[model samples]
Each structure stands twice: as C-alpha cells, then as structure tokens.
Target: MNRLFDKSIVLACCIAAAVGLAVDARLVAAFCLGVIATSLAEVAQGNRARRASETASYVYIIAAVFVPPFVPLAPLAFYDIARRVRREHAWVALGIGSVFAFALIADLRTDALTARTLLLTAILSVAATLLSLRTAQLEREQQRMRRTRDELQERALALEARNRDLADRQDYEVELATLAERARIAREIHDNVGHQLTRASLQTEALRVVHANEPRIAADFADVKRTVDEALQLVRASVHALNDNAVDLSVQLDCIVEGARSDGGPQVELEALAEHAPANVANCFAAVLREALSNAMRHAHAKTITVRCMEHPSFYQLIVTDDGADATPASSSNVAEGMGLASMRERVEALGGTFTAGPRVGAGGWRVFATVPKPQGDEDR
Candidate 1:
C-alpha cells in the first residue's frame, strides 16, 4: 500500500509541472508558495507552538487557493524554506497541497489541457500523502509498545534474581539451625549418659570383686552391663552432634557398628585400651578399628568380630580379626571390592600410616590391621 501511494505522489508532481508550464507562470508560482507556507506552519506545530502555527496554517492555505496557476515548482521552494526552519510536515504537505492548488486554478480556464492534467494529479497526491501520514503514526505507536515490552522483561529478570537470593538465604539458615541442634544433643548425651555409664561400670566391677566366687553375683554385673548398654545407645543417637568437625574415635567406632547392624550382620566387639595411649593415637586407632570391624561384619560373615586398639610410643595399631564361621555372601576374591576396606586404607595412609586386610592365617577368618603414624606433638601427651 505504501509503495502504491508513493508512486501516485510522483505522478501528481509530474502533472503539476506540466500544468505550470502551460498556464500563467506568475499566478501558479504565487499559489505554490502559499501552499508551501501553509504546510510549513502545520508541520512546525507537530511538537512546537500548536495554536499560533495552526492559525497561520489556515491563512497560508487560503492564499494558496486564491492564487493563479503556472507556479509549478514554487511550492517546493517554500517547502525547502520550512525545512530550514525545522518544521515537521512542511515539506511533505507542500509536495501535495501545492499541486492541488495549481490543479484547482487550472480548472478555471476551460481552454487549457494543462489544467485537466494538474487537477487529476492533485487528487492522487492528496490521497497518497494522507496514507503516508497514517502509516507513520502506526509505526510510532508500535515502537512505543516494543519499548514497554523490553522494560517489563528486564523487571521480570530482576524479580527472579531476588527470589533466588532469598531461597539461598533460607537454605543456609536451615543448615545452620540443624548443625546447632546436633551440637546441643551431643553435649546432653556426653554430660548426662556418659557420666552415668562410667559410674555404673565402676559399681559392676566392684560387685564382681565382692562376689568373686558366688555364681548368683553375676546378676549384679548384668545390671551394670544394662546400664552401659543404655549409655552407648544414647551416645549413638547424638553422635553427629559430638563430631566437632574433627576425629572422634569413640563415635566413629559406634557408627561403624550401627552400619553393620543395619545390614543384618553379626555382632562386633570393640576393645579400646587407651590407658597407655596418647590422645591422637586413641582417636586414629578408634577410626581404624571401626573400619576393620565394619569390613568383617559386612563381607566376612564372621560370628565373632574383635577390634583391638593398642598404642605404642611412635604409633598406634588397630587389629581387627573375626572368626569366619559363616562364609561371605560374595565369593569373589576382589580384595578391593565392596568391602569398605579400601576407603579405610586411604584414610589411614593419608595420615602417614599403613593398612592391611585379608584372610586370617590360622583358620577360617578375616582380619584387618592398621598402623597410624603419630603426630610429633602427640608423642609427649
């Protein structure tokens, strides 16, 4: 549609030129000038002084109508002047209106063939100019809408970022609270249950001494054993709290037993003789002991598993051996297989130590033994 309108406008300019050449040049030129001035006034008002320009626009338009013909290019000259003045529709309206006025002036002369041409051209130009203006207005509106859409999209992205930040903060808070709760529970178990277990164990030892020959005195020992069992359970339940983000040998051993029990395996015996051990040696031995026991219970199907933790001046050795009364569920000899033995090896070796696990030499059994290097400062302690 725009192409058709532009073509029509060009054709109108051709006809107006022809008419101006044929008619009285002075009259046509004056009329063209008037048309240019009117268009300039109207165009200038597009974003400027509207009321005053509008009134001037009417005056110029009337003058264009009253002027004579033969002013073929006069309207374009006036349009150029308006362009220099930075008016909006000046050049465009002058292109169409000047020709229109010339056409009307030519119609008054019945003998002039040029007048007929100008009249026809003027009609086409007017139609084309109106169409062009309407299209331009539509384009402006579309541009505005697109800008608004872009702004909305940016706002949405910002909102999404803010929501993600809030979610991350919430997750952090939850993790912090969980850690805090674990710490509190661990303290409770150690202070309350641990003390009670120590007292009960002492009492049981005392009773066994007093009733050394009496078979019935076993009952008193059993009562103390029950108390120790309860203490262990309490410790297990709150062990995560006790972990201080560092090695806790006792808790580590208990965890291993718990995991083995969950797998429906045989029971385990953990023997820790820390009375002659340094604190570091005690902790590392406990870790190795648990790993050894876990492997025995899970892979060896041992009826009786024993973890013996012993410490020396330079290092600590954890000896875990089991009676292989029951064959392992898996028969493959992949020493580095499902047994947590490899992971245990890595842990001990990382601390500058050695670890070994394999079938026992004497009988149907499996054993895991590890030696952990002692820290320099821990040797004195």
Candidate 2:
C-alpha cells in the first residue's frame, strides 16, 4: 500500500484494540487478524517474507486464544515476535506454540503455569526488541548509501562540464595559432621575395626607358645588361639571407627604394632609428613598410613618401606617411578597405603589437603606424 493507506490501517488496528480492551472482548485477536491480513497483502504484492511469516503469526494468535485470561496480549507478543524472525527462526515459532499449549493445559489457578507463561512472554518480547534494533540499523545504512550516490552524481556532472569547457578553450587556441602562423609566413614572403622581384622589374623598365631612342646602339644595351646582372646578383644574395632566416633590414630597404625610384614607382624616403636593431624585428618591419609603400604608389598615387622608424625603451615604431592622391577623395576609405591593410594589421597584432592606418590630419594622403616589440638579443642587428 501507499504511505497513507498503511498509516490508516495501523491506526484502525490500534483503535480496534483499544475499544475491544475497554469492552472486555478479544482485542489482541482482532489486532492480530488485521496485522496478518495487511502483511499477507504486502507479500502477495511481492513482499515475500511479510506474507510467509504472517501464516505462523496467525497460528500463534489462535493458540494464544485458548491459553490465558489475558490471551489478547499473547497475539500482540506474537505479532512483535513474527516481525523479528527471518526464515531460519522457525524454532522460535515452535517455542511460542509450545508455550501457548502449556498455558492452555495448565489451570489459571495453578501458580506454576502462571509463572512459566509470564517468563516465556518476557523472552519473546526481548527477541522482538533486538530484531527491531537490527532493522533500524539496516535502514540507516541504506539511507547513507543513497546520500553517497547523490553526491557522486553531482560531482560527475560538474566534471563533465569542466571537460567540455577545456575542450572548447583548446579549439579556440588552435585556431588562433593557425592564424598567427599564416601572418608570419605572409610577412616573410612580402619582405624577401617580393622586394627582389620589384627591383628586377624596375631595372628592366629603366633599361627600356634609357634606350628608347638608341635602338641600334648595341654597346649601350650591353651596359644596361651589366646593371641588370648586378641587380640580379644582389637579389640572389637577399634570397640566400632569407634561406638562412636572417637579413639586413637596411640593405633590403636601400634595394626597395632604389628599385621603386628606378621604375618611377614613387619618391620614397626611408629612415631607421635603431643603433642596434634585431634582424628579425627589422625583417618584419621592413615587410610592413614595403607593403605600405607599395599600397601608396599603386593605389593612392602618392608622390613623396616618408617612412620613419623610431626606437623606444621596450618597443619600436615604424611610421609610413604618403603625400598621394586619395583613393576616395570626397569621403575617403579608411584602413578597412582591402587585404593590404588587413594583412598589415594581422602581421603586427599577431606579434603582440598595434597597427593603425588612416588619413594624415589636414595635409595629404595616408599614414600607417606599426609598433612592434624588440626582443632581448635583437638590440644590435
């Protein structure tokens, strides 16, 4: 039964017992019948021991009925004893039966039988009390196990959440690393190979310009060929330096300006503030500066460009200012226009630095400023 039904049944049995006792009727017998019926129902509902022990319980009550003037009390004692026994306690049930039989055969007026019944009742009561204590202990253990299970379930859920969080963080870190590597490789390509190619293209254009009217003068063509060969050798040296992962930024900048001027790219001025600049830092800044200058000449139509490098205590700054025709003169586009600025931003920011490009206030074209940290050993390159 549900809790309410079980409670009501017990309450009804107690009330019946009280009324039967007041009216001098078979009160304990009625109570035993109720307990037996309920216990049997519990067993039929799959509570096995409840119904099985209840049979012995009912027999004990019938025996008690023939025995004493206070016979109802015998069933109450049997109900308590039945609640205590496991299947192996059949001997206890037989002992209860024998006590009830002896009580019935001996007369009530005999002092010996009265004393014996009293002693037997006391022993059964003690056994019931001990079994009740053991049941209480088992109940407490079950409660303890239930609480432990709840705690473990909570911890398991928390650990799962933590693992998910860690996994997400790792994925984000991986993506960031990939983007940084791309930026580094881009900077390498622009500052090294791109500069050399631009120089070669400039010399070829210059040779073509100088020999425009001397189509038949083969000696002047040979002189142009020698200059072309020297430029090629210098380009080769720069390429070699890149393979070794180091290059002189000053030399690279000279080559870039010379090539741009020769090809009529722009009138570009370059400067450096480092008494001892690191090769790696130089290479990165050179890449950024070259891209800026290329953007000014190709798109902005900048005429006079000044590229300045300034050294600070912890960081170095490269500033490229151009006096060029603005792409959007009416209401101009800012640094967000194309991949050139985007690439410059990515290169600087990935190295834990800042990049800002905008129109120079009032005077003319665009300004790009990139600040990069100088590592410890790079103070003198």
Candidate 3:
C-alpha cells in the first residue's frame, strides 16, 4: 500500500502538470492511453501480462513522442527502468536513452523548447527513480526482519521442549526417591521391630513350656505367649503392607520387558499392563509373563510372544501368547503340562483365580491366560 501510494502521488503530480499545459480533447485521450499502458506495465506480474505490458510501455513511449501532454508522464517510464537497473543493466540504459530521444523529438516537433519544461522533466524523473530505489531497499530490510523473527521463534520453541523434558525427568527422579525411601523404612521395620517381636514370642513360648507343671503359672505364661504371637503377626503384616505400598508396577513391568528384549531370542512385546493393581497381583502377572517367555524359548521355539494383563472390577486377568510352531497341541487337544505352568497355576489358584495354558484354538500359537479375583483387602483399598 505504501509503495502504491508513492506511485499514485507521482502520477497525480504528472496529471496536474499536464492540466496546467492546457491539454485539448485529443491530448487528453492521448494522455489517458499513455497513463493506462505505463501503469499496466509497472504493475504486471505474470509472464504473459508482462510481455503485453512491455509492448504497452513501447506504445506509451511512441505516444509521448507525438503528444506534448505526455511529456510530464516521462517520469513513469524512467521509474520502471531504474527499478530493473540491477537485474537488466543494458535494458535500463536502452530505456533511458529512448526516453531522452522521445523527449527531444516531442520538443522539436511541437516548437515548445522551453527551459521550464526541461527542468520539470528532469526533477520528476529523478524523484521517481529515487522512490523506486527507496522501495527496493525497504523490501530488503523487511525480508531480513522476517528471517530474524522466524529464527527467534524456532529457538524459543526448542527451548520450551527442552524445559518440558527437564520437568518430566525431575518428576521421575522424585517418584524414584519416594519409592526408595519407603523400601528403606519397610526394611528397617522388618529387621528391627519384626525381629524383636519374633524373639519375644519365642521367649514366651519357652516360659510356657518351663511352667507346665504348675497349673496357675502355666496358664498365665500360655496367655502371654499367645499375646506375643499375635503381636508378631501384626508386625509382619505391617511390614508387608509397607513393602507393597512402595512397589511401582509400571517400572517393574518395564524392567521385565527390557530384560526379555536383551536376550535377543523371540521378540517380546508387552501388549498391556493394567494400572491400580494390587502389589501381589502385579508380581503374579510379571512372574507368569517371565515363565511363559522362558517356556516359549526352551520348548516352543516361538517367533513372537505377547504379554497382556488387566484388572477388572471383580478380577485381574493375564494373557501370554506365543507363535511357537514346534509346540502345537496333541491329537487329543492337550498340551503337555510343565513345571512352570504348574507354578503359575498354583500361584493363581492360591489367590482364588483360574489359570489355563494351551494351544490357541484356530491359531498356530500357544496361549497362557490367568484371571485372579480382586482380593477383599485390595478392593477395600
């Protein structure tokens, strides 16, 4: 807009000068044609229009040679040539030389060779050329500023991403420190308080045994022994609770998957590991996953194994499947039971859950699935 406004002002001044020269009707029509052609040449963008504009520019120069009114509009031609000087030096020289030739021809033919007319042409041409050069310089400055702004914005985005990473790392460290502290506390209680309680129970049992011949004293010692036994149980339960609370299931499962990956045997992917699972359930699922992977590696010679665990409202479920071609089910539809399968079954059954390991129906793979009901205590928690 600013550039166009500058050009508009120069064109208006040229028109005002033409009016002062008392241009007749023919001169007015000639003036309009030259103005239209030169303006189109100045603003033309595409190649086709630019070619047509160049032709019009030539026509405008030719018209100026015959029409005296067009003498003032010579500045537009000079401005266009000046703007292209850096890109087309030879064309600019030719264009400028043509303008001088046309101006000289118009003056000689019209017999109006005045000092004022020459002075006016010189001043307007210089002014229009300066405007073009100034506009080009401004555009270069704006481009530089845009590049700097874009670079600064990129740096700012990178810094923000780094800050987010640092924040996440800090949060993980704090969580690790908290878990470590809890483990330390649980260990201290087990070693100190639990040990002391066990010793008390043993000592009381000895007293009860020693006083068995005396009815009254034996009864009293037996009661004390029972009391000490109950205290010991409470201490053990408290220690277990502390340890369970410290367990991070996600971290434990991640480590298990990472260790399995290091072996470079069958590819292992943890399909899922459910959240909000009790510590015992998490441990059981992880153990089942490890056992299944081991069996697949040794006997099944599986290509891939997938481990999935989920905690439902009523039960926790685990599924470990493997694509082991060598270890398909027998004709009777029974896969041979192994010690590892037995252990997993026992673990789940002990927790009031069901466990199954078999050749996947309608598939060329083995599937080990287990589902344990949510413990009463865990449900309450």
Tens digit of per-residue lDDT, candidate 3, span 1-381: 656777787788676555546557866776677567667866889978876876665556556666666667766765665555556456755675566766765585666644466566667877887897888788789999998987786566445434544553465457557667878998999999888988888887788888889889989988988888898888888777767643556667767777877566888888554666755566667667766776776668887988777656678788888899646322112236544566677767867889988888999889999998986766654
**Model 2 lDDT per residue over 17-75, tens place:** 34323333444554555455545534554456655655655564565546343443443
Candidate achieving higher lDDT, 2 or 3: 3
Which regions in candidate 1 have their CA more than 4 angstroms from the true location?
Answer: 1-113, 206-230, 233-237, 241-381
Candidate 2 vs candidate 3: the TM-score winner is 3
Candidate 1 lDDT = 0.56
The candidate maximizing TM-score is 3
lDDT per residue for candidate 1 within 1-381, as digits (tens), equals 443444345435644655535456655555555455544543563555554554454444444455434333333333323323325756655654565566465555744435554554455435544545565566668889998887676566445434544553465456457657767877777778777777777777778778878877777777777778777776766675354433445555556665666445666777665344433344455545554554465556677877776656777777878887434322233323433444456657867889876677777787778888677876766
Q: Distance from true position, residue 288, model 2, in Å?
A: 37
- Measured by lDDT, the strongest candidate is 3
Error of 3 at 197 (Å): 2.8
The 10 consecutive residues of candidate 3 with the worst lDDT sum are 326-335
Candidate 2 wrong stretches, greater than 4 Å? 1-29, 32-117, 213-381
After superposing all C-alphas onto the true structure, candidate 3 shows an RMSD in angstroms of 18.2
